[model samples]
Target chain A: MESHIELSFEDIRGKQHATLIHFIGDLDATNIELVLEKVFNLINEGTVNIIADFKQLRYVNSTGLGILLHFSKTAREKGGCFKIANINENVYEIIEIIGATTLLEIYDDVDEATAALT
Target chain B: MTTQRMEIDIQEVPESEGVVILHFSGDLTSECVRRINECFSAVGKKGKTYAIANMAEVTLISSAVLGEFMGCRKRLIEEHGDLVFCGLDLEMRTKLHLMGATKIFRIYTDIRTALNSYKWEIERQPEKFHVSFPPYLKIVPPLRQLVSRIARQKGYGNRDSFRIETIVDEICNNAVEHGRPKADDLIDLTVIIDPDKIEIDVRNMSDPDKVASLTAMLLPEKTDTDKPKPDVKRGRGLSLIKMLSDGMSVECTDRGTSVRVKKVREE
Candidate 1:
């Protein structure tokens, strides 16, 4: 099934941009490629600071993580930062155990991650 | 396949009406928190002081689900109910204990004993078997559903089934997305189900060096005064698998990398 993934962008402060990508429904192989494409597009446009708001994200598999890693690398190379905010603790732990916390910043709230970008 | 409605029933105990019994079933994930909250809210309406979750029929609960449990407990206490738990299988209990919730929730072997201190009747053990799958990127949800059904037939509940499904999805997807050189490259998955526990073993013929690098990449050495740079997406999958399963073992031999996940059945 196709996932209803939503990506919202907001300019937090200065060059610090917060793109809130809400992953709704299943983020499986069916639509992960599209999601990755969207993420790359945002990074290519220099949308540096990103906060993936996973409040609405129901599920995410390994392919989803691969996409996130790809974008995180791109963001870092461009001197930008990528973070995830407002994630459910379960989702946060999933991200944490995968050592995503080591590679990407995780915030309890969007404000905190946005503040870091500033 | 029928999409089941989430349901929770809370009843006041006769001896200690302060203790509420929460019976829940179906998939308990982040999305189901609102429903769980509603159940807690209903229990709060009764004005009881303490509560216990009757997890007998509950098959699986994710870390997110556990968070919701804690969150609900906090909410209940704020309204005068102390939260506890009953009917957790060894797998669920172990996960909760590992997360330090065993200290948080008062766990019992069964609902009747938890409710009235009556002799708890433990059910007979279920048959167990192991099955393996080849790693590939496109995960077959139906196959996962079938496995879950098999588990349920063996007396595992929906919650446990969901846990198995989630782990399988994570491991198989990793093999497909990162482990294999091509889409057709096989990722082997094996599930061993016995009365006591279910053990999942997944193997893929990927580059061992790449696997080692992936492992190293997961635990980056900390430098002075600064946090390590986030890799963005590549790292969370394995970590999530580790967090969800009771125990995990990762081994990379000359041929491939193997990940084994075990979930014990509750009595």
Candidate 2:
């Protein structure tokens, strides 16, 4: 299969404290780099706080998990926050399996992740 | 070589004779998986489940076929039968072993040996049916319907069966589109269903480079894409297959490439 992800941002709690990245489609070795590079660019832009929305994600492989970890780690190094929202059951299972479930702040929805981070 | 679309034949060993086997030849793939699903649905309609699959002549297989195999095996086991595979070459056995499927399915060296393993009641099986179609894009839908009907007939819940249908749709579309098929070019598909497992094979005349590219990505542990480029289309079909099926394999040859996929149903 191929890979597709739409990258976009929204402000949470009417404030621009965090960059809410909404991801759609499969995330694997094929396209994980594109996503990570975007995250790096967002951090460089000084919006260190990130809320990754995965509600629309169809799939994620091991490499994608690594990129997610790298995203969070990079945010932590910058003294900012990295959170996630709306992760579907399938991707969540893989996340849990990799023992990274506790590595990030998980919210049931984008609004929650946004509110908490902001 | 010859542009033969594909063919599906259900060869049932006579009841009073030897063990019952569903023999499949030609290309076994997602498109063919539907036919295999239909055969089992037909078996399910008759309220039977004991099955053995013979893959002596199967030259190709796909991931959807693997998913179907596992689904059917689980169904058969629930009904008090087992899905056993026989007549596999060393390469096929290694493929199953590598995918960690050998632990689940009963493997045999040959039909005679597989039959000798147990005395199965020859359940007056239905006559085998065969169908062939062009590799053209237009006919893919009806082909997928055959698999969807099998899932429904096998009593799969709506969502579960739909997943199976989608897998078939994705692979067949790829097979038709990616195949550097000349005019009148055909891909062969075959599905064999038994109480234990379902087998699907797909064969296509493909450029060696295309085969190499797919094979590399198919192995995830040692993986990377050909190169990072703007993927105009992105929905990892191969990854989805790896996630869903019990096992899969790709065989590349000078003439063409064949892929076989098998799945062991959850008990």
Candidate 3:
């Protein structure tokens, strides 16, 4: 069965060209391939500076967390950065438990992530 | 029919003493009866009488080899033990049925079923329960949610219940990611809930090599400075499980791997 997760992209024209991808449901192994493909497609299309808005994301497992980290690394490799904003407590707790709070760039909200995008 | 030579490899099933699994491959013909007999006799000499004949790769078998098989089974049964057959193909089943050997033999589709046929009694306590499912990621969410609900039902706080759920998620995800399980394999989850502490065990069938690499990754010997860099994508699931659970232990065996984690409720 497929996991219930949706991704919507919004382009932000500012200090750097960035794409804001909003996660609407749980991120997991079932839907990670699609998420990865979308994120890589953005990066290859010169939208390397990506901001992930996790405000609506309800749940995430280890597999989902791994891809988020991968996106951060891949975006940075192409002279851009991957930032996350508006993370819920449950998902943030998972990131803290895994000690990845410092690995991936995290902001308090979309505005904060956008202001810091480079 | 393909290769005239037959190959046999034997391994003792861990945690099940006196039980050995014999993997048979290639053609079992008259030339190989003596060798096969010697293997069976050698296992019997080692006092391992409960044998499982894995014929998943056998292409052909002569009448002499079939006779030898029956003889070995009879000898083991006489000693109050038995030999079982598993992973038999359609051709092999037809051959056995045509020879009327299926009536006297206990055959199963895979080793897991054959192992469970032993009917080893598990101690079912009031506060403990077990669940087994195929190794699929889609099956993990409900399992984790069930663990959390159980913890909450046992009076754990919301945060503690979430921690229990997180622990199950990471361990089960690790099993699916690194266990290298086949389609027929299963992942077993056992939970024991107490008033103050909860224990969870996740076990999955995997080969020895995958188990070895998982052991190294989960229980790495790296210092703080040698940890994965900020941009690292993997190698965090095991750490999350370790950090969330109060105590954790991993057991790796030839047949499978088991990870046990303990969580204590906070005040």
Which is better, 2 or 3, measured by TM-score?
3
**TM-scores for candidates 1 onward, in order:** 0.47, 0.40, 0.62
Q: Chain B, TM-score, each prediction?
A: 0.44, 0.48, 0.50
- Model 1: fraction of the reference interface contacts it also forms: 0.46
Model 1, A59-115: lDDT tens digits are: 566557667666777777877777777776545545555556676677777777667
Ranked candidates (TM-score, high to low):
3, 1, 2
In candidate 2, which residue ranges exceed 4 Å CA deviation? B1-264
TM-score of candidate 3 on Cα atoms, chains taken together: 0.62
lDDT of 3 at B262: 89
The candidate with the higher lDDT, 1 or 3, is 3
Give the best candidate by lDDT.
3
Instruction: Report per-candidate DockQ.
Output: 0.25, 0.05, 0.31
> Per-candidate RMSD vs. true structure?
17.0, 18.3, 17.0
By TM-score, the better pick of 1 and 2 is: 1
Q: Cα lDDT for residue B172, model 3?
A: 85
Alpha carbon lDDT of each predicted model? 0.66, 0.66, 0.82
Deviation (Å) of B12 in candidate 1: 37
Candidate 2 structure lDDT: 0.66
Interface CA RMSD, all predictions: 4.0, 10.1, 2.1
